[model samples]
Target: MNEQGEDTGIVLTEAQKRARRSRSIAIAVSLVALVVLFYVMTLVKGPMMLVRPL
Candidate 1:
């Protein structure tokens, strides 16, 4: 709210919008990479753990 105590919405500039988009894409890619890493780890450990003792 401004000095008048009126509620105002956010407005993003062109550069700000682009930066936000870039950050969003980077976050999405990082999330996907992490998921893939977990899947690979499960595949690599799943069978061996079943046969091997704790």
Candidate 2:
């Protein structure tokens, strides 16, 4: 038995699932924001600049 009195392989609880979903949504939003920022920067200049070396 695990700490919750069940097997260690137990699936996530409702709250845990919700938390995971929220995290995923947050990640998606952050990615979208980054993409928008990149697009805006590229539009402001002649072309996208390399912020870091490849």
Top candidate by TM-score: 1
The Cα RMSD in angstroms, rounded to one decimal, for candidate 2 relative to the true structure is 5.6
* Candidate 1 segments exceeding 4 Å error: 1-8, 47-54
Candidate 2's error at 17, in angstroms? 0.3
TM-score, one value per model: 0.71, 0.68
**Which residue pairs collide, candidate 1?**
none
Model 2: ten consecutive residues of lowest lDDT: 45-54
RMSD of each: 4.1, 5.6
State the lDDT of candidate 2 residue by residue for 5-46, as single tens digits.
887776799999999999999999999999999888888764
Give candidate 2 regions above 4 Å deviation: 1-9, 48-54
Candidate-wise lDDT, in order: 0.90, 0.86
lDDT of 2: 0.86
Residue 32 in candidate 2, Cα distance off native in Å: 0.5
